[model samples]
Target: MASETDAPVDGVLIGEEATPIDLTEQAEVADASFAQVSQVQTVINHIHGDIGGASFGISGSRTKSRRTSGPVSGHEMAEARTRYERHESYEAAAQQLGRCNMVALIGTAGTGRRTAALNLLHDFVGGRREVVVELSPAYTLEKLATREYRKAHGYLLCDWPKDDVDGSIADFHLREIRRRVRDAGAYLVITATATSLPAGDQILWQPPPARDVLLAYQVAPEIAAEAAAHITPEHAMADVVALARDLAAGAPLDQALGRLESAGRRDVVAWFDAPRSRGELFEMAAMAFTAGLPEASFESLLARLESIAGIGMEKADAVSADDPMPSRRLLRVAEGSLFSLSPGRRLEFKVASHRTHVMRELYQRHGMRLWEPVIEWLHECAALRDNPSAQAEVARGVAILASVSDYSYVDSTFLTPWARGNGVMRSQATAAMAVSWLCLDETTRSEVLRTVSSWTRASAARPKFTATLAWSGELGIRFPLEAVRMLWLQIRNSEKPVRHAEIALARLFAALTEATGNALPMLDWVARQISNDKRIGRAIDPLIRAILSVLSARADGVGIPTVTAHLRTRPDSAVPLAKLWSAVLVKRPHRRDALAALYDAVCAFDERDDDDRDHVRALFAALVEALPAKERPLLAHDLRRYAISRNTDENRLEILLSLLRVFLSPAVLSLDTIGKHP
Candidate 1:
């Protein structure tokens, strides 16, 4: 190994008469002032360019003896001197090192400990022509005992002795080296990370505060302070140094920023979006944009921030309003008492590109616990005067509510006024309100139903509403049965068709059927309205198709209660129920319960003496015959059994005729024990 000296022995002028010792060119001695290697130390297997080199399976022989060495000449000592003067912390450490007999400069990498050690050595010599011999734990004891081993002023040891090296061996070498230095009346200065070295008169050379680092790179004090405010003290200096070097080399901005974090801190750094914690800044800015700056008051704003952050005021002081070093993400206005968007600053939080990402992080992590506070703040905003911007702010709040699925704001008091407005804000607000309705808790949903019910009665101007029923159907929210009945009456009484009303009616039918597990109420109501007024039925045929489409997608059978209720109450329900059964059967023929219910309804002919029963039975027979061949036998058996059990001949004959007509289908060729019809 090369000796830790700046030049060869002949270079130094030690008072002109005495020749300086060539510590580098000395014989490999078995005796010296420091311990030397005597036994085989531990070995490690290493990959030599296994990535780009071949592997060395075992590195046992490679653990050879190495002498610990130190800087011997002042050739490049000027560079070390300049770094010492640049930062106050380094200068302080150098001064402290001058007074200690054995000083260890300890810190993490990039903390500048070695520079301080070399500078401290410079102070120790007082410009004398002396050299520092660095000792290694690997030196053999016999080599240390050799007579030719006496050296100059002091010894230097830096990060040495690999961690897995035996502890007793390392301690023996360190003790021998200290004895050699003390016996020679010489100095010993060791520089290492905190993890490796023994406790001593240690001078911790932390990276300078960010300000000094920025100043070193020629950053203006104010700008540097602003940047410094964004990062922790431990990180600020390293980031500044990396940034300055990259900027000096004209590296790209991202590349420069990427170097700010070392590998060990990558995960912690990822939590910060811009080398700083800007999440709180963006959230407060979002609140300010609508609430009016400083008008909200600092204490009140801090409380809101604290609430969202879910921390007490004292614990949240770093990002608090009282933080002396506030982020440039927001600017202090009015002599720092109030805050607002900085003039000419072009607030990045407002940019559409990053806005959603910032908002998502805020709501998903921080604002999750602030739901009640956010709702109250929104209520305040909603009370603002109905200007376009105020309305737009309220609309934005509605959108935020939708994004987080916070649906407590679906009340008529919050929604009705904005729903009636004109323009883009109104449109967005209307859609957002519908989404909120669909996402509301069951209790809130029930409240919304009552509100809509009241609104329909109280509203005479034919209030405009969207296909909210459709949205509810999509979200699986049960549409209110009362709203469906009320909307059906409007359809029946209207002289002309209302498009939105029809869409709403269709969605309500699907939602109610999904909720009640049957289409009976919806079908009964529609059939009753149609039989009472055929004009309305013709007007609502499109709605019927839409509802049927929704039901067909949901392949589950209609409930038995639904069939029994409709069959007992309205004979008119048979044909419509039969049609629904056909629609469901066509989609899912394997739904045996639907087919059985359809058959049961057709046979419940005794409950209805009207002529509609024949049409219903005929429709049922046609649907039954249309089933795939595999499904025909079981359905025919069910029908024949019902027919035989009929209480009267007229009922039995009506059913038999329907059954016989069904058997005539080309697909149904078999005859059961009752008789062969063909």
Candidate 2:
């Protein structure tokens, strides 16, 4: 039923001829990618039991139900009340909240601002029948005005959107919300950064002494004082709390603090050494790879993990029942789970730092005992086209594993197979995303670049395709010039040209031009490539088509095309423009579109400023000069005919015609042309 290329190679399916996926705008892609990385870091901070950070999400109607209905869990409220240490501004903030029925807590991150909000609410509702509900960060004054509030309840809303914190908030909107709270006999406390609020509305809160925080957690006074000595101002309250727990458990002061400094390495070691059943181990391994994925996706991955471990569902069920700890308790103890910003709940480790450690430990201690099966499972995950976000997370997990484990082993086991084996665009995307993430760390960037460079030269189509995706997406966006060079190498050296690579080059050039508002760097690169006699011969058609695509690309709100804007600012771009146009006109496929683009750019230059005429003249002269002597007259004739057909102005037409004649003169036409000059 399937072609040879579509069949499985080893465990991975080969899809070298797979169609490329459509790329979204670079800004959107960058935001999603950055959020993925940020979420990973947030999970890692959870290793220290930090609660200050929340999952990333944009406010939308889909999240409105979750935002409004969920109350702050009782455990969270109890923990906050027990551990909260009053800051210098606590009394002032409490007084404000009691008086106005609302107070905004403002401070930098990791300063216990959220905890302070919870505690303030707790004290306000003391001896009263009330619940503390955390309103969504997306909550607004309008919602406050409209929604019915339960009498005597305390509300906490952390990290309110900054855009909503404008001058109106200090005036009418704040007054209105205050009126609503007072009328309902309820108290509200909103936490935000100082920058997000008006100076008058900000009740500045600073973290209290670390010793005070440790003592509040019921640590021995002597140990608390001693541990506080090691705590820097930059240390979050969460980290201090974690340290206190260790001290209460009889850990040495130095070793307890050392664990905090060591990114949960000691904890990870302890976790593996004390682990229980096969099911729990498999679940941890699955979570290590699938954190931040939806619950259904996570369950799917868990099933796959069991299959890879040679544990049948029937056996797994028996093992689960036989285990002393319940599945729910095990989930809490082994892997910390949380709901993602997306609609469904997602799973994540309680201590995200343990994720990297788990991955590295499995590879080191288990070796092929786990790596081979994990690799095969990843290929199966990559083949699933329905859940791209899940696929991307899998790739990110691998990149994290690669960061801590043997780079060569991880590369060979996962990236190389996915890149060379699957023609699936999603699989290639997985490889590309992994490569991009690896490139983020300076320590691994060189090796990643070197490996990807070699892939561009690979004889297999899938490898080249994967490399093209990397160069076009995050890699190209971050390193435009180098991306251009590598992409050019792929295009030139291939026995036959790759259309996707050419399109990627055009897209890269267009994105850079739009972002920087200057196309000189890209234009310069194109000029150099076009100037090369041998290289240009091998890649002439794709090069010309790519140039045409870049010229035709439009930026939002810009009246002129990309090329017109470039020539207007940097007249020197005309040389490259000429060389590119000369090649385009000589190629039959792109000739008509090239002529239209040239005429449009010329007309645009004329309409804007008379000073642009010199650049236009130079562009025409060089374009004609770069063509064969026999073709120069024909190109000049075509240009004149096209301009007149578009009803060119008589004076401008005369100038263009005169310039064309001079450019087409025998001496000028005798100048060297690109390659063999057709």
Candidate 3:
């Protein structure tokens, strides 16, 4: 995030007395400065385009009239040349274009492949009297054999061999077209969306990097450094040409996204309206995640949405152009691509929220079965953790997919642990597993509950799973009553208290209250678990506090009997019982039995395990402070008698003195204050 311009620049100055400057040193200095600027400037320029550069011309500069296809006018031609030179790859592609006779250029839309092809053709023509004609995707072999097609010395075919067009049929057409052109001593250049073209040298078009975006827009160094502080180089450079053009037309950075989103939406909607197979159309829905389809097998799938919606094969070029096919127009409403090209041209989605929105709709329509292939692809990428960028992308997708509420076809083996079983997906996969848990039939749900009753193995995975269930329950999504009951039972049955168990219980308490619209079930469940779970000595205080907090907030019921019965049953429940009294006494503070329970729990201590005895002794000392001023006298007498009973044991006697001092001198009851006790 540091300013690029603020960094010290390396220098190698040449004086007039010097014979010849070392070119190597000068090159090093220039490379260092370029590297510094490239990282910072590209990010800033992407969000805020350079206003002084060329206006919106990537798509806008192209001739609008579909029927009129050829080289653009003089001014537009100049703009394409300037944008192409902003990167070395564009220059290389342009140079390569002139060398090949039958050249097939393959690339996704908006990658500047067509523009590079046109530039090469312009240079190839030079000042000679050479004829040039561009055939549309709709062109046929029969049309190419005509005098006008055969007589032309050069040719350009745009978006040829549509998705449904057979490979053999398209290849036969290409072979004959090239033969006729070679026989006539003419040249041909075809720019098609097909994955692999037949009989021609092919070039894959790579889009300019983010840094080149700043170069194409003529962004100033100082201003770019200031803007670059907040963005990173990995940010998507989609439609950079359009961005530069928009900025050149005087739009500000703040207003550009809104305008861009509106325009992008219109283009995406049009692409969905074209005719194609149901299977191919389904792939378009998946395109929201994959970013861009690769060219190696573009014919096997749909290309850019624009390529299909905007271009169609000539009736002759398409084998089934007239045959009736199933309609795929139901998905016309789903629009926009969250994924964009990285510097390596690999697909990545920058925003998590956009991914959630797209996946939500896709699931709502076709369900999780539709996501099997996408999930498999994500799993494959996730295993490459050595690449931190890829790991982060996979993590984001995992988070979005985890939020899926529907459980149809979701199972245990769905998200297998990868990276040598390190359990990287454990946390993210917990939510999805919660959904699967909710889907079980009553008998199976109960049997599954009995399986996890122990608190030993997979302890980490259990708490997260329990928390996720409580989380979903609070959202008003229905889980079986038996499932909730068994969860509460498992918490009660736990031999060793789980970390974050209190938080998990609170969420479950909230979920139960929301699910039934009543507080009695939650209160009853909490009261029963306190008495039934004998291992509650450690987790009791937190569990009671969680119960009290929820009960006070809702204040929906007055079931003191159920609470008192559970507390009274546990003779050693002073710590938790005292907390229960503290909450209940807010309404009825004069409850004598609640005070009696505290006194008995204090006097009944047997001092067997030193840790348990010390913990209980501290609980009783704390409870003395919570009692009313008048009630303290009775607690004082009980503490004094208990001190005499433990006089023979040094540790118990010391603990007793600490408790008595708490009642006799309330301000000095703290552990630090007790340390200075006689």
Q: What are the TM-scores, per candidate, against the unseen true structure?
A: 0.28, 0.49, 0.28
Q: What is the per-residue lDDT of model 1 for residues 251-359, given as tens digits with 9 covering 90 to 100?
A: 6545555544332234322433444343445454355323333333434444554455454445554575765764533343323222334354322222221222333
Error of 2 at 542 (Å): 3.4
List runs of model 1 lying over 4 Å from the truth.
1-413, 424-439, 457-462, 467-476, 509-517, 534-576, 579-619, 622-678
The lDDT of each candidate is 0.42, 0.63, 0.41
Clashing pairs in 2: 15-423, 336-350
How does candidate 3 fare on TM-score? 0.28
> RMSDs, each prediction?
35.9, 22.1, 32.7
lDDT of 3 by residue, 33-54 (tens): 2222222222222312333221
Q: How far is candidate 3 from the true structure (C-alpha RMSD, Å)?
A: 32.7
- Candidate with more favorable, higher TM-score: 1 or 3: 3
lDDT of 2 by residue, 1-678 (tens): 123255333223256544333332233443333333333323322321333321111000011011122366565667677757776788889888878888887765556777788788888775333388766443456666667677889987765545434576546666677788899999888776533445655698777888887787688898898888877754555577778778877888888887563445556677677745777666767777777777766887878778887866565556655568646534443433321224446666555565666776676667666667777888887656667677777877887777666567768777777776533345666777777656443234445665666677665566666777676544554455667787877666655545667656665554445433445656778767766745443356666666676666543324677677777666777777777777678777777898898878777776344467666665765676567778877877888898899898887788667767754684543224211221
Ranking by TM-score: 2, 3, 1
Clashing pairs in 3: 55-245, 56-245, 138-314
Whole-structure CA lDDT of model 1: 0.42
A best-first ranking of the candidates according to their lDDT comes to 2, 1, 3
| Reference-based lDDT, residue 369, model 3 | 46
